[model samples]
Target: MSTPSYHPAAVALQAVLALANETEREVADRLGLNLTDYRALSTLSQSGPMTVGNLAVKLGATAATTTAIVSRLQSRGYAERLRGEGDRRHVHVSATAAASRDIMNLMRPLMDATNRHLESLPAAQQDAVAGFLHTARHLMQNHLNTLSTKDTA
Candidate 1:
């Protein structure tokens, strides 16, 4: 067997992702939500109201599963389904005000601390960090696209 070498940046990125997942888990726990529900609520809050189908796609969940998730959210007073004004059959899922408030309250401390850390860096270092993260996000999206294409093909 051959040993495989890993890049330091790749290792660091993996650590960052693990930390993010842990944070998300803690947030979800405090909200009395499962991870999926927390993620769905977060998506709705950030993206505004969207069709259940669109939300399913974003969440990489089946339509039926998405409907169930929405139901759970609605029951918890974290989300609601709204009918389109013009189309009676069309419905959108939205995060309730309470969901946004609770999620923000849970996250504000972390957000403030992260912002402070970024602000403490020199301007050039701040820009460099921002640029690195932006590029990394783009690269990850591209990789996801490639994998999706391969799966479909």
Candidate 2:
């Protein structure tokens, strides 16, 4: 059998993913958080305050596991749970100001590195990269949803 042709785009995508994973690991270590904890905090930072059930769904974690994650964050003073006034059962988890600051500090280096690379690109190339990433994210989300449904079945 002949060797398959190598695609530069495919190789670049793989390298980008590997670098991102390494960045995540570095940030998590700097913040003294496990990968799951860091991911939960990252999600909370992006999505703002959300109920535990909603967070669990987002994290693909069970209710018990989510609760434990929340508890850990709460104990570390990184997060807090707010109970609704009218509906006490409605609990929402939010990152504390300190947690947000810490996360930002931990991520600043990676963000700066990525920004430097992006800034070096021409405007048109930057736009093209952004569009490609947006489409890639959407496609990944669709694939994940399909796999999730299959696993549940």
Candidates' lDDT values, in order?
0.95, 0.90
lDDT of 2 by residue, 109-128 (tens): 87899899999999999999
CA lDDT, candidate 1, residue 39:
96
What shift in Å separates residue 39 of candidate 1 from its native position after superposition?
1.4
Model 2: residue 97 alpha-carbon error in angstroms: 1.3
Best by lDDT: 1
| Model 2 lDDT on a 0 to 1 scale | 0.90
Show the colliding residue pairs in model 2. Answer: none
Instruction: State how far residue 21 of model 2 sits from its true place (Å).
Output: 1.9
